[model samples]
Target: MNGNQKTEPTINRKTARELELIQFKSGYEDGTIIAQQQHMNSVLGAISFAFFLALFSAGPDAFSKPALIVSEISFSASLVSNILLFFFYKTVSGKKDLEYIWDFEQTSYAEIFKTIALFAPIIGTFSLIFHYSTLAFIFSAFIAVVGFATFLLAKNQISLRDSLLSEYRLSLLYAGRDEDYFTLKKHEFKQKPSAEELKINKYDYSICNQKKELIGVVTLHHQAVVGDIIEIADSEPLTVLRIIHNERATKLICKEYTEDTSAID
Candidate 1:
């Protein structure tokens, strides 16, 4: 037995379809969330740019120097973060094919820029409003703390949901063979079973020639009946000659069907 040739659990056609549907739904939801976040970032970028322009036009005397500088820096940071995130989303989304879902959580750049973009505007606005009075500034700081805590809570919830969905999709991917169906076709002939002692299971099949010469064993999940033509591993197409059933299991007797073999048959 080949050490690498491990058998996979068989999934019926109906169960496979169900797994496929579940995978599709999970991908769709993930894509939707990504799109929503992209849209939110775009909107926030525009708002931050507008505020930056307004502050710049207000001149040095319109607000205290410290307040003015901090506000300008905050808005600029938010704007830059949003722009970087926008391009990141575009580049990542464009490179990926439509076959797989976008996993945003996998990229730390995305999370960092998104968080900065989301909260920078709030910080800038509060700093500008409460700049003049110490008491007002302290109150604004308390409110900002509460808001930041709320945002963290919401972010945690979203992360938890994404983690669960990712795990579920991974389980479904492993449970079904759809992802590796074509890869299985390239399996090499491993072991040949003896004619006197043949074994038939869900994944392993024994093939023999008409004279009971043991050919090679192939892994097949479906039942092989007489007259069914199947290409075993790297061999030519072989026609099933007969099926022998004993108390244990059934054995397949096959022969290569070529022009010469056809004439002989």
Candidate 2:
């Protein structure tokens, strides 16, 4: 039989709400130290590989004595960038900011720096093309950008941790089929949400305060039925509550409904 002969069970696509919930849950869990280190090594190796490719493209004349200085300069800059990335990974590894590394709100230090480094090949290639090749400038720029991004990522992540530890952020997120219910609409200072039923169908679905300030979340008291209009509230998001009801209308909640101020902002 052909490889395609095997049959597989059908799988339903994840709803926005389901995907959001999965992300939320994953954030709460932490990755092992080994996994974090492996991530760093992978990035460093990739950057080094790209640099080699750049050097190869810089032409045979690169080996000539006059061009030696420029080639070395490019290599040095790429080296610095890689070194900085290594430190960034090490910093994260030691500090254990797995949450921030994987956070939607934050970009990984490795990614930003590695990206900055990834541009090094362009600089080297250009240097080789020009008669007065100065690979120094390009490599220097790469090093500077990646270095700065690494510093900023580290600083921001540390600052975020300190701030969160000091006080709760009081945030809420909702996403499903309705802008009113699933997509986060608004928030207020006072955590004010009582058991209210947003009746889309005749069913008296309920909503309550989900977040305790730091990060409020909500769930169906029972397995969410197909037509339940659940309202959610968070103290920081102050007044807006997500009103989820049905599947056919999830997109309505993405941007336009978020602009309306019917819920608290």
Candidate 3:
């Protein structure tokens, strides 16, 4: 034995599965944000076209001095909102590093577009009321649909922002550690099974097992020693299958192993 076994391993099958699920959830949120941003671009395009169509359809009589001022103000606001949406789409569509993404999320200007987009229908309805047009309700309803779409886009972006922030915090845990862990270039296997032993450093782990092979990565919250086997909270026993060391961090590759085994046949 490498050392006296004291405690059990903390990572097991169930906790590994939960970590995988968390990664999937974060990925889904990111995809939803991108899809919604694209959809907003298309929706805003249609809304812009309709805005101009309604303004022109009103004809010369539609713009008395007072009416003209109201239309100009509302249309200008809508135009500015469209410009903001365009920039937002550009940022999301282009390839961005983590810093750029963080910066974009921090800006308050994007919220202005969201607010304008959400309230556009109200402005359109007001304009129609002044014109006394026959299709006033229809135009107002169309703008309302666009506004609601914008609302959904904004909500998804908020979710994505939160998830990215969470991911960034996780990344920081390994961002600056450069000399703590060393990578294993080769692994040795024994002709027959031997006692299990695990060596844990600050960020790296070395598992000693005669009949062992490379397996997938696992996470743990607590520490363990050579002969000690630990279990995650309410999970099965964690049997260390292998170990992987990289510059970013050390991963314990594990699987359940209860019986002694010979080397590869």
Q: Return the top candidate by lDDT.
A: 1
Badly placed stretches (over 4 Å) of model 3 are 1-35, 65-73, 91-98, 101-114, 133-210, 214-243, 247-265
Which of the two, 2 or 3, has more lDDT?
3
lDDT of 3 by residue, 145-251 (tens): 89999999999998998788656555655675332222211222335422321222223353333344423333443454333453444445666544456786554
The order of the candidates by TM-score, greatest first, is 1, 3, 2
Candidate 1: regions farther than 4 A off = 1-30, 62-64, 90-104, 132-135, 145-265
lDDT agreement with native, every candidate: 0.72, 0.49, 0.55
Top candidate by TM-score: 1
Find the 10 residues in a row with the least total lDDT in model 1. Answer: 94-103
- lDDT, candidate 1, 1-265, per-residue tens: 8999966544664466677776755644545445666788788889889988888676764455777678888888999988777766655554253223345454786568668888898778876776657688888888878999999999999899878866766666688955464354346347665442244335556788889877888776567778888787779999898988777656789888664565563
Q: What is the TM-score of each candidate against the true structure?
A: 0.40, 0.27, 0.39
Report lDDT (Cα) of residue 52, candidate 2: 55
Model 2, poorest ten-residue lDDT window? 249-258
Candidate 1's displacement at residue 79, Å, is: 0.9
Model 1 TM: 0.40
Q: Which parts of model 2 have CA positions greater than 4 angstroms off? A: 1-73, 94-96, 103-112, 121-265
How many clashes show up in model 3?
6
lDDT of 2 by residue, 160-248 (tens): 98676434323222223355432223442355333432221132333333332223344433434433343446222223244455643
